[model samples]
Target: MTESAFINITELTREFKNKTALEQITLSIQEGELFGLVGPDGAGKTTLLRILAGLLQITAGQVVAAGYDLNKEPEEIKPHIGYMAQEFSLYEKLSVVENLMFFADLYNVDVKEQEDRIQKLLSFAGLTEFKNRRAAHLSGGMQKKLALATTLLHEPPLLLLDEPTTGVDPISRREFWNILTDLHLNGTTIIVSTPYMDEADRCSRVGLMYQGELVICDSPVNIRNLLDGDLVKITTSDWQEAHTVLAPLAGVKEIQTYGEALHILVDSGKTRLPQLTRALKEHNLAVDEARTASPRMEEAFISLIRKMDQVN
Candidate 1:
């Protein structure tokens, strides 16, 4: 392992009774890096995080987290990592503070420091007012925050979060990312798997998994640049017809629908924009708006997935 690598994996593979969950997966994460993992369902994001947390055994390869070899010392690596699974793993009957206290005990937090740590975490997670609320009664967002707080009780330098904000309200999702940003700024290494592209854009670096393989790992900007085409967003009524008319047009690569908008990917927006507009007019489609726009993380991800699909 390199001196700067906080977590290192090589040819890491995990298998089940009759299927492979992860294969030939190799990744390196540096300390204090906010890494985002995005992928389709069954893409092995959760499996990889679980393996790093020492919750699952690897079927092959090597993993070294925080200098502890997972193959040889999975238990020793646990204290240096805080892992939050996708589901709400806390006790529903327990109050927020009680859950924190319970996790504090499990993590063997210092008795003298528990009070200060718990109080600070409550404030940090915006749960000070609802600290006494039972876990089951808290909103989905609040429950996720509480789960994060519990994971932090041990002051682990590395955090592994699997879809922590899934099914959460927009406001809560933003708040959760805010806390993660603060943690990143304060030198915590966080590896989070998220289904949201906006959240993936906020990461220092992103790893895209597909069919159990680490397909691409790079900065958000670089990933977006990999779209291989320009994006042209066309807003119009009867988008179904507009899509059909433009989909087979020259230079058109792909089209993604968003309500009344058709985000069209083409070889060249400059050359294809007017061509597409004219075709829509010929078809008598009422074009409300048509313009070239920046390709976002979502477009890049979808493009990559499509390419992979074609290959497979």
Candidate 2:
């Protein structure tokens, strides 16, 4: 591992009974960097995070966090890292302020420093006005923020968040990301996992996990660049005929219908679009509109998964 890396995992593997959860995963997360783990459900993201937090034992390989071996020095690692699970895990009946105080006491924070930390966290989470509100009475987004505040109360160097914005509204998700950005700016190393591809773009680096294995690890731009060929969106009067005509085309690799439009990936560029249109016209398919479409991160993710499946 490089000196700058705060978390290092080498050939890490984990299993529950006869089922493997993580498979020979290796990665390095830099100090003060915001890294994201992107995967579908049952992709082993939570398993990896639990192993790094020392909450779960690894079946093989090694994990090092903040200069301590995860298996050997969990106590040493615990004080330096904070973990927030998918479920906020806040006490439902406790007010936001009380919840924060409870965790501060659990982390053994000094009484003198606790008040200032709690105040700052409340302000940062936009919960200052709701400090006296019971967690059970708060909205889903507010509850999530309160949970984040509790996790951050002890001022850990590293924060591990699992689907922090999963059920949050768009505005609340934006606010939550802003808080994370602020934490990163203050030199906190953050590792977050989400099933949403758009959320992965928020990280400095991303690891794409599938079926307990990391299939791709790179910056979002680099991952999108891995997608080859050109994509075209075709909208026509006769959708079925257009799809049938395009599916058997010479250069077309894939065709997927999205609502009223068909997204076609071809080996060539706009030149192929004209030929496609011409072919559709010959088949009595009334073309309404056809244009080139940019390859998005979601498309890249799907392509990567398909490629991995082919290899397996």
Candidate 3:
């Protein structure tokens, strides 16, 4: 392990019955880094996180977290890590403050200092006023906030969040990410897993997992830059016909339609755009607009997946 790694997994594998939950996965997350594990459901994200949190035993390979061996010294690593599972785990019948107090006590927090930490967490999560409300009565967003507050009660140096923003409204998602950013700024290493592509872009580093395997791990900007071409957005009256016509065009690598616009990836400096316009016109499709645009994270992700599929 390097001097800077907060978490290190080398050839980690996990099996449930006869099924493989995680392959020989290896990754290194730096200190104070907000790292995102992005993949669809059943991609082994939850399994990997559980292993890192020492909640589940791994089938093979080594795992280290916060300078302690996950397999050999889970108790030593436990104090330095906080895990928030996919489901909100608070006691539904208990009030928000009561739940926080319960978890604080579990962590052996001093009674004198517990109130100050609880108050700060409540304020940070915007649940100050709802502190007395039962967990079951709060909205989904508020419940998520309370869960987060309880997780942070111990002030662990590493936070493992399993789809924290899933099922959250857009505004609430933004708020949740803002709170994560604040923690990262304070030197806490955050490892979050999500299926949302946009959320993956917000992390300091992103790992794209597919079928229990990590196919790519890099910064968001570097991932987008892997697509070697100028992205052209084409808007035509007949999207179906336009896509059909442009799909076979020379230098066209991929075509994705979003509403009325078709985002096409092509080799840089290719004159395929003019050819596409002419072809659409021949098909009686009105070429209302066509212009170059920057490639988004989704584009890069799709491209990487396609390439990986072809390789396998």
Per-model TM-score versus the true fold: 0.96, 0.94, 0.95
lDDT of 2 at 20: 92
Please provide, for model 2 over 133-189, each residue's C-alpha lDDT reduced to its tens digit, 9 standing for 90 to 100.
999999999998988898898899999998999989989998999999989999999
Error in Å for residue 288 of model 2: 4.5
Number of clashes recorded per candidate: 0, 0, 0
- For all candidates in order, the CA lDDT equals 0.95, 0.89, 0.89
In angstroms, give how far residue 68 of model 1 lies from its true place: 1.2
Cα lDDT of model 3 by residue, 206-309, tens digit: 99888889988999999999899989899998898888888987889898778989999999635777877888888889988988888988888888888888
lDDT of model number 1: 0.95
Ranking by lDDT: 1, 3, 2
Is candidate 1 or 3 superior in TM-score? 1
Which model is ahead, 1 or 3, in terms of lDDT?
1
Worst 10-residue lDDT window, candidate 3? 268-277
What is residue 22's positional error in candidate 1, in angstroms? 0.7
When summed lDDT is taken over every stretch of 10 residues in candidate 2, the lowest stretch is 71-80
After TM-score superposition, the amount by which residue 224's alpha carbon in candidate 3 deviates from its true location, in angstroms, is 0.8
For residue 76, give model 1's deviation from the true position in Å: 1.0
lDDT value, residue 124 of candidate 1: 95
